[model samples]
Target: MPAHRYSELHTIPFYECNVNNRISIPMLINILILASEHQNEKLGVDQLYLIDKYGIGWVVTSYSIHITELPRKDSVVKMTTRGTSYNRYFAFREFWLHDQDGNELVKVESIWVLMNEKTRKITAIDDDVITPYQSEKVRRVPRLPRPGRIEPEDQMTSKEYQVRWSDIDFNGHVNNSRYPEWMLDSLPMDFLDTHEPTNIDIRFENEVKYGNRVTSSVVVDSSDNDKIKTVHEIKSSDVLSASATIVWKENKAEGQD
Candidate 1:
């Protein structure tokens, strides 16, 4: 069968950039998510369709993104996405970003699961549902390295965050992209100013709904401070909502990191 894919062009807006004037990691994630939504809409299996027809919604289980070059503000870029494969309860997707000249800048891989809206339990993906995307069924989907386990003693700092209405997505839960924002915010301002993230791997363990208070905890590697791992759980709660490992590189002069 022919590969099913979707592609679109986007201009980097000023709000999406950080102090360095390059596209921020969270914004990159949002763009890739939008691309996936667009593709699903074309295939008639989008959020609205699934929620209305199947009483289910898509929840991202994990994501891994590798950035070769960060797109600068005001630059136009093309993003493409496609459904790779699926099995039982899980589906895989891939995303790519390119410059105007078609030079690849970034690649992302993600895993998603179907959740029953009423029961709040994971449900098996229907063949009729995934068939529209033409995603093949695979024994094992492609994945990136899982985020490292965070030990209790390694916890450095923790901050509590109240989920705002703005953070909620159509599924009535905190958007997946928002987790990166929360994780990055837990870092000191100086660390953020001095270093930039090159690669990020995140795993979502549970859903965080609006009005939930979550605490983001950071754990820096003892051997290398540049490698930071964080875990976020609902405040005063034991449920682990998400965990991420971000590799940072010191920023250099003239837009290099």
Candidate 2:
């Protein structure tokens, strides 16, 4: 079977960058999703097509991203995505972001499940769906480092946010990319300024609908002063909606400590 990777070029706009002028994690995810969608469209299996033809849609179950560097505003980067493999109920996808000079800036792996749009039930992935992507069934899919479970004692800070209409996707729920934004916003600005996220792992537990409110909680682990580990939870009406873990490294310029 031929390889099925797809690539797209993007320019990091000013609005996608944070105050520090680096691309925000949430925006990076959005770019990756866009790349994946473009590839799916080429394969005739994009979300809209799936929902229309099969009454099913792809829903992300978990994701892990490793960041080597974040592109600065106005920087040109290439984003690529491909289907790695699949099983009866799950599909594995991989994404990468490369700088103009061909250095990899970000790598991500995600697990997705096909859900029946009308019944909202998990569905088996059809062979025809996987065939176009040239993906094979794998006996064991590679797993990323799992995010630590949150404990009662670890809850350090919490903030509540209302889901806006704009946050709602075609599926009538808050977009998966928005969870990371909510999680990151719960952190102190000082910490965001002093550190940059190097790794992130997130699991989606429940869906948050439009007009619902989500409370994001943050727990910090200071075992290593140089490296910070933060655990996050997004709760809706006191029920867990999603959870995440983010690892950070001190923000320093090239050749600086």
Candidate 3:
């Protein structure tokens, strides 16, 4: 088969949106994961095959996605992805989201590290995997900004969510990815649907236990418009649970969370 690169599409549904009837953070994350699965098919490996064949997995270390518009219920959105390059431990990939009419909606670039299953350390992507994709080396690298932080004394907002039995993973705690839900959940309805998040750096600080009430809050720095930073913090009293920053595009009216 000839080696080629192509982008696939995914549609947004009503359940994917939040109270604002806009696409939620969790749904956005879910869409990207699905897009990657299809993109891998073009490279002779879907998500499942890649994980199983190499005993290797791709984890998102950092990502920045700018959303120009929200995909409404039953609206079809097209997503295109490409492996831009690989520099040792960092593999660069770009994804573009668009309307069926071909208007670009969101642009995302993500950095990932390949990991060994049992040892859980960074590893190299072999030539076999590398050669299949016609990728060029990204010469000029753009530095991503750091995620935000919240002080211990900072006043915070809270949300009480029951750790349903289904939310518990094999590790016996709420899935780390679920924190984005709690984080974004703290934002306003208009903010959830609009605004493009130009940057977002999330670090998992700790695990959220089942049946525990996790309060969430955000810290915003009003200094720069080129980049808007909002910190997502999940905590109990003074103890921290997890934190994330959603960097918005110049337009703050769209994504408040």
lDDT of each: 0.82, 0.89, 0.68
> Candidate 2 — which pairs collide?
none
TM-score ranking from best to worst?
2, 1, 3
Write down the lDDT that model 3 would get.
Answer: 0.68
What lDDT score goes with residue 147 in model 1?
83
Model 1, which residues run further than 4 Å from truth? 222-236, 254-257
Q: Tens digits of per-residue lDDT for model 3 on 1-257?
A: 33244676666778898655667667777787777767677678655665678877666666666677767667888877777776556677777888988998777777776766556677976666656666554554344444677877766565666667777754466764577877777766566555555556665545567787778788665578566667877775557766677777544443343
Better of 1 and 2 by TM-score: 2
Best by lDDT: 2
Q: RMSD of each candidate?
A: 2.4, 2.0, 4.9
lDDT per residue, candidate 1, 45-79, as tens digits?
88889989999888788888888788999999999
Model 1 lowest lDDT segment of ten: 227-236
Q: Please provide TM-scores, in order, for all candidate models, with all chains considered together.
A: 0.91, 0.95, 0.74
Q: Candidate order by lDDT, highest to lowest? A: 2, 1, 3
